[model samples]
Target: MMTLSNLTSPFPIFHFIGIPGLEAVHVWISIPFCCLYAIALSGNSMILFVIITEQSLHEPMYYFLSMLSATDLGLIISTMSTTLVVLWFNLREISLDGCIVQMFFLHGFTVIETGILVAMAFDRYVAICDPLRYNTILTNARILQIIFVILLRMIVLLVPTLLLLKRLSFCKTNILSHSYCYHPDVLKLACSDTKPNSFWGLTGLILTSGIDIPCIIISYIMIIRSVLSIASRTEQHKAFSTCVSHIAAVAIFYIPLVSLSLVHRFGQSSPKLVQTMMANIYLILPPVLNPVIYSLKTKQLRGALLKLLLSKNLPMSS
Candidate 1:
């Protein structure tokens, strides 16, 4: 069994994700990722703007939508800043401290993003399942409190794992197999035994991404049940259409997540570019598609977007 450490001097490692002979692909993907980042930032910014400006959107669903947009923007920034740096330099080596900070923010927003998604799903459930009580149940004060607590908990939960990772000895290998300082990727390169690292990291992942997924499922389950119970066909259609974007967003985000996990567990050392591509997709695609998904599927959001754009054009037209 040839170990990763046994590889030849200089490691012959490609700069992109670990895929050999696929550096060009990484560059190509980076171009689109930049585009995706722009879209995530701009689109989410627009959503935030519309939500804040429009008095009518002060309800629970829009409130959660705003929060979701904010978190998605954070998620994109956290994941892609380090990613773009790696691509620009084409450098595979990250210092231990740099790696730890990257890992910390990367997963910090990841947990909070998952929590935000779960919150949005619950908001939708309340709106659809208990419409009569939606106003009282998801008031501004309550929503703000929930968001604050979730954000605080996510940051606190992620910090200790990051600190634990920082305490490990690197044993001279500074080359990270992935583009960013992923916990598992960094742990793999550690000179010391990694069982503890792997165990805790997996535990963290399960708590954040893993646990949040099931909760999303349950929320949607209730949402679906409630939608079906509506007596009017028009109401049922409206409710289902409202959920289309959320379902699409969930699928877009999680599919890449599953793919990335599988690649990490199975494709370690295969090629750097492949690893890079997976990571890039994991970080970039969801944010890019999120606004697009919601704008196209959600009538209120689409109207708000169009009105905002038209308003900007009015001065030029005059």
Candidate 2:
């Protein structure tokens, strides 16, 4: 028995559509979504565990990998409860404050991950371009400094976004088109002018992922040039082999992200289901596949995971 006054009150609550136009099958769709969440959670947790516990992995490269896993975990957990509850139980009501908080963490973690990937590219560049100076270049203190800089950048960029959203008035419909809150999604629902919010959101994106991708490309070009200068083909192969894991990780992360951005920008005419599905893939695929890609591509990580499993199993079996 809700009144129009309550619905349109200054403290209005927002509702999510949870895959608009597909309500009848939401329960069925939750199965695969749940499985993806399970895999992302366990895989990232395993990566963090192996990297932290194995003293052999206490290097700059693995430190970056561990940070990547942690960011992925944050991204996944940020949307987990809201998304699953909407799809599984039709619970779509969320407070305006709650929506803003979710949007903050989701985009914040994404920005941090992009920064980490860029740092990893720098790691690969140093490891290959100047192997002799790699240790001096990426000391433990330097690694910690890079991590602090990433977090600080995200905070400074996102605080304005939150403030802009806070000043907006939401007199129009409070229904969001997706299962979780995103800056763009939430901004579009505001009855007032959202130019400031939109501008900050785009600014944040360009500064983070937009800048990161080009830098990563430049780093790779340098790495390839360095690899080619090696006197022996065996040395060249060894150098390129070290990069395969990082390259795979970059591909899996950026491809879906770029695709989703394109779809959002140009696919307004496309089916709602198509946009929704692409968004889901963009959010879920990276965390689920990153660990698998590393485990398959990096021999040392695979060996460490094997040893960890064996040690645990031996105790239980005994």
Candidate 3:
């Protein structure tokens, strides 16, 4: 006889999804998730270590790779706290303020990662399209400036939407579709008129991912043109090869993001589990795969990684 209306509190509590209609299997599901979290954490951690310690990886390219790894780590940790506990212990509840904090970093790092990719694209563009300018264009100071702009942009674009959340009323069901706090997921639960939230949210996406994706595409196109102009076929191949890992990184980061957006915007009749899975993929796929992809694709990183592993495993001298 209890209604959702009566259960509403002064401060709302949000519940994260646990595969919807498959609650009985949450414990079993946690196993793979736990393994994934381990891979994400350890893999990114090792990547960071090798990039920092290996003199070979201290170039502009590897510096960007380090930023990519660091951002992936941030993305993983953002969701790990709420998501793992919800699945393992049935602790699905989070207060409004908590949800906002999670959304901030979850989305903040996401934006940072996007910007890093853009910078990486620029790095590649300069290295190939204008080899002489590569050093001057992407100096350590310039990299620092790019990072500062990314952080500043994240704050400029993301903070206002979250700040506005304090003014909304959650009179409806507060259960979010994914195990992490997402902006759209939380925005929909607000009973107050949310046109401003919707507006700024869409505007942020337009300004962030919308602009970044095209810049990457254009960078690649220019890269291809530059490669084709090279007389020796072997050098062209080598130039293209360097871009493979970066291209892969960009694909994994944006594909799920685009697919999730499409599903949410048009797939109203789709199952809740489908949306939940889509959102999970959006968050988990990149962090889980980036380290492996880079390790396998980049010879320098792979070699450094192998050396580090062998050194740690070798027997100590008496």
Candidate 4:
């Protein structure tokens, strides 16, 4: 018989509970979760495929959309396997290194997505606010440079958090609250002091998501001012219309994120099911909704998608 000590030895394996206090209904719950995952995967994949294949989409804005799709794909991949395993097979055991890897990718992809949103905001800002200089400012080389900088920033900031986590000794229950391994959720399982881990984690959050949100807001503020300054109601409508898809994407991504944070901080007495649901929404909604929003709102993407699909269905000439 395996002893309790053997199960939770220093840096021992960790298990994830799909949703605390809701194991009895995990199968039923997984039905929706699996559907959402499929949607996220298919939608983001279609966006990437269309953007890459359509030469007409070789613009800075579309490039940013590609990056957004890539980031969402990464985010979904980071958690999908582990989450599905837990839900489908109840295989919750995760080694320490595996957990760390999951935490890194999950948080890193999230930060990258946030950075991409900020970049997209800047793309919109330039397109709307400084249309004359848009092409000159967002040259292909410059966009590539911006993506490199965003990725480097995320990696540098996340390393410290991972290092701190690795240093902490886990001697407690070794069970994670959610299906996925998050830095904070993992940190809570450590028996040793996690102040450094917590401090660095919070700092990382501030540096990435925190900074990105304000910069995005500032970009939109400038965009709104520029749009309003246009004398024609028609031009103003056009400008605002261009921003609608981005605004919707931002809202879906941030609202659940903020709600999850609030629930974690203030809803301690709230049911675990509520907290888990919010977290799932935060993880799943944006990836599933963003491409749909873009496809519906952006005429260029819709037209390209229709053309692509129609071409595939048409008979090939010999």
> Local distance difference test, per candidate?
0.75, 0.88, 0.91, 0.87
User: Candidate 2 vs candidate 3: which has greater TM-score?
Assistant: 3
TM-score of 1: 0.87
Task: Write one digit per residue (lDDT tens) for candidate 3, span 1-318.
Answer: 986556556788888888899888888998898899899999999999999998988899999999999999999999988877888888888899999999999999999999999999999999999999888888999999999999999999999989989888897468888898988878878877899988999999999998999999999999999999999999999999999999999999999998888877788689998998888888889988999999998998999999999999999999
RMSD of 1: 4.1
lDDT of 2 by residue, 170-271 (tens): 864687767888777677677778888788888988898879999999999999998888899999999999998888888888988888777766776888
Q: After superposition, how far is residue 220 of candidate 2 from its true place, in Å?
A: 0.5
lDDT of 3: 0.91
Residue clash pairs of candidate 4: none
How far is 255's C-alpha from truth in model 1 (Å)?
1.7
Q: Which residue pairs of candidate 3 clash?
A: none
Candidate 4: tens digits of C-alpha lDDT, residues 63-144: 9999999999999989999888888889999988898898889889888888889999999999998899999999989998
Model 3 off-target regions past 4 Å? 1-9
What is the alpha-carbon lDDT for the whole of candidate 1? 0.75
Runs in model 2 with CA error above 4 Å? 1-8, 315-318
Identify the leading candidate in terms of lDDT: 3
The superposed Cα distance between candidate 2 and the true structure at residue 117, in angstroms, equals 0.1
Best by TM-score: 3
Which residue window of length 10 is worst by lDDT in model 2?
Answer: 3-12
**Candidate 4 lDDT score at position 27:** 83
